[model samples]
Target: MTERVEVRQNVLKENDRIAGELRRGLAERATLCLNLISSPGAGKTSILEGTLEALGGTPLRVAVLTGDIQTERDADRLKRYGFPALQITTGGTCHLDASMVQRAMASLPSPDLDLLLVENVGNLVCPASYDLGEDAKVVVLSVTEGDDKPLKYPGIFRRARLMLLHKIDLLPHTRFSRDAAVADARRVNPEIEVLETSCVSEPGLGAFVRWIEQRLAEKRQAGRPARD
Candidate 1:
C-alpha cells in the first residue's frame, strides 16, 4: 500500500510540474487555453462546436484539440468548422495528461491561434486530477446527466473557473432543476461562473461567445509573442 501511494504521489507531482511548464508556454504565446472537462454525453463537444460556429466572424482566432480514448471522430467533427484542430487519442486513459496535450500541441497547426480549447476526454473524475497547462478550466455538466453532478464531483467543480450547463433545452422534458443545480455548484465553488447553453436552440450561446472573446481580448492585451 505504501509503495502504491508513493508511485501515485510521484506521478501527480510530475504531472503538476509538466503542467506548470505548459502554462508558461501558453502565457508566452499569449493564447487563452481552456481545459474543458465533463462526463460522457455532457455535450462538451457540441457546445464548443456551436461556439466555433457562432464566433465565425468574431475577433479571435480559435483552435481546438480534442482528446478521446480511441477514435478520431470528435476531432473529425470539429474539422468541418474550418479552424486548426488536432486529435489526441489516449488509448484507455480516462483523462488527458500534460504529456498528451504537449504532443497534440506539437501536431496541430496552432501557432497563431488566439484561443486554444483543450477538450479533455469525457470523464469528470480522472480529468480533474490532471492539468494540461491551460489559462482556465471549464467544467461542463449537462442537465440530462443530473442536477447533483456539481455536488457529486466536487473536485472538478471546485477547480473550474466556469461550469457550462449544457442541454438546458431539455429541462422541460427532464427532471433537472436549474436553480438547484446552480445553487449546488455555487455552494462548492463560490466564484464559479455558470452559463446555460443549448446547441440547437442557441439560447445562451451569446454569453458563452462573449466569455471566450473576453478571454481572448485579455490575451491580446498581454502583447506577448508566440513561443516557437
Candidate 2:
C-alpha cells in the first residue's frame, strides 16, 4: 500500500512540476496547445489531418508536433497539407513526457504560430498520467473499436475535456453502436464534451470545428491567447 501511494504521489507531483515549467515556457510565445490521446489506430492522426484541412483558411496559424515510436512517417504525411509540422520520435516510449515537449518547443517554429497540436504516442493508458501542459486534452475513439472503449479506458476518458468518435461513416457496414458508445463515455465522464465525426462522410465536422473556434474564443475571453 505504501509503495503504491508513493508512486501515485510522485507521479502527480512530478507531472505538475514539469507541467508548470512547460506552462511558463509556452507563455513566452502564447501558443495554444492541444494534446491528442487515444489507442493505436484510433484516428488521432487522421483527425489532425482533417483539422488542418478544416482550418486551412481560418485565422488560426496552426502547426503540429506528432509523436511516434518508430518512424517520422506521420509528420511526413502531414506535409502535403501545406502546414509546418514536426515529428517527435519517442524511440519506443508509449507516451510523451513534459521534457520531450519542452525540448521540441525550441526547435519548432514559433512567434508565427497561434496553435500547436501535439499528437501524443498512441496509448489510452499511460498518456493520461502525464501532463504536457496543454490547454485541453482531446481523447479520440472510433466506432469500429467497439462501444465499451470508454469503460475499458476510464482514466483517459475521464481526463479528456473533449471526446471524439471517429469513423462513423463506416458504421452502417459494421456492428458499431453510436448511441451506446456515447452513453458509455458519458458514464465515465458526464461532463466531457463529445463530438462525432467521419472524415469520409464529413458529418458533424462543422460542429467539431465550431467547438474548436468556441474554445479558442473562450481562451481569448479568459485572456490566455485564443489559439488553442
Candidate 3:
C-alpha cells in the first residue's frame, strides 16, 4: 500500500511539473486556457457549440481540444463553427493529463490563439484531480442530473472557478432545485461563479460569451509588459 501511494504521488508531481511548463508557455502567448469538466451527457459540447457560433466572425482566435474515451465526435461537432478543434482520445483513460495536452498542442493550426478551451474527458471524479494547465477550471452541471451533485462531488466544485448550470430549459420538466444547487455549491466554494445557461433558449448564453471575452481581455492585459 505504501508503494502504491508513493507511485501516485510521483505521478502527480511529474504531471504538475509538465502543467507548470504549459501554463507559462500559454501565458507568454496571452492565451486563456479553460479546462471544462463534467459527467457524460452534461452538455459540454453543446455549450461549446453555442459559444463557437456566438464568437464566429469575430477577431478572437479560439480553439478547442476535446477529450473522450474513444470517439472523435465531440471534436467533429465543434469544428463545424470553423475554428480549430482536436480530439484527444484517451483510450479508456479517465482524464486528460498535462502530457496529453502538451503533445496535442503541437497539432494546432497556431499556438497564438486567444482562447483555448479544453473539454476534458467526461468524468467529474478523475478529471477534477488532473491539471491541464488551464487559467481556470469550469464545471458543467445539467439540470437533468442531481441537484446534490455539488455536495456529492465537492472536490470539483471546490476547485472550479465557474460552475455552468446548463440545460435550464428543461428545469420545468425536472425536479432540480436551482436554489439548493447554488447554495450547496457556495458551501463548498463560495467564490465559484454560477451561470444559468441553456443552448436551446439561449438564456445566459450571451453572458457566458461575455465572460469569456472579459477573461480573454484580462489575460492579454496581464501578459503585457509593464511600462516604465
Candidate 4:
C-alpha cells in the first residue's frame, strides 16, 4: 500500500510539472484556456453551443477540446460552429490530464486562437484533481441535479473559479433551489463566482460570454510587452 501511494504521488508530481509548462506556453501565446468540468447530463455542450452562437462573427477566435470515454459526439457538435474542435477519447480514463491537453493543443486548426476551451470528461471527482493548465476552471451544474451537489463534490467546487448553474429554464419543473445551491457552494468556496444560465431562454448567457471575452482580453494584455 505504501508503494502504491508513493507511485501515485510521483505520477501527480510529473503531471503538475507538465501542467506548469503548458500554462507558461499558453500565456506566452496570449491564449485564454478554460477547463470545463461537470457531471454527466449537466448541459456543458449545450452551454458551449449557446456561447458559440453569441460569439458569432466576433474577432476572437475560439477552439474546443472535448473529452469523452467512448464517443466523439461532443466535439462533433461543437464543430458545427465553424471552429477547431478536437475529441479526446480517454478510452476508460475518468479524467483528462495535462499531457492529454498538451497533445490536443497541436491538433487545433491554429495555434493563434484567442481562446481554447477544454471540456473535460464528465466526472467531477477525478477531473478536479487533474490540472489542464487552464486560466480558469469552470464547474457546470444543472438545476435538474440536486442543490447539495456542491457539498457532495466540494473538491471540484473549491478548485473551480466559477460555477455555472445550467438549465435554469427547467427550474420551474425541478425542485432545485438556487439560493441553497449558491450558499452550499460558498460554504466550500466563498470566492466562487456563480452564474445562472439557461440554453433555452439564455437568461445569463450574455454575462457568461462577456466573462470569457474579459478573460481573453486580460490574457492578451498580460502577454504583451511593456512599452518604454
**Could you say which candidate leads in TM-score?**
3
Q: Please, what is the TM-score per model?
A: 0.90, 0.89, 0.94, 0.93
lDDT of 1 by residue, 169-226 (tens): 8888899998998999999999999988888884867778888888888877776565
* lDDT tens readout by residue for model 2, 1-228: 355443335647876788888776555556667899988998888888888888998778888889999898999988778788888998989999888887777786664566778999999999998999888899988888888889899999988999888887878877888788888888988998888887778684677778888877665566555585
Off by over 4 Å in 2: 1-8, 27-30, 224-228
For all predictions, the C-alpha RMSD in Å is 4.1, 4.0, 2.9, 2.9
Q: Write model 4 residue lDDT over 1-228, tens digit each, in one string.
A: 355443335558878998999999888889899999999889888888888877778977889899999998998899899888899999999999999998998877778878888999999899999988899999999998889999999999999999999888888898999999999999999999998888888485877898898888888889999999
Q: Using TM-score, rank the candidates from best to worst.
A: 3, 4, 1, 2
| Candidate 2 local distance difference test against the native | 0.83
Candidate 3: 10-residue stretch with minimal lDDT: 1-10
For 73-119, candidate 3 gives per-residue lDDT tens digits of 99989999999999999999999999999999999989999999999
Show model 1 residue runs off by greater than 4 Å. Answer: 1-11, 202-204, 223-228
lDDT of each: 0.86, 0.83, 0.93, 0.90
TM-score of 3: 0.94
TM value for model 1: 0.90
Clashing pairs in 2: none
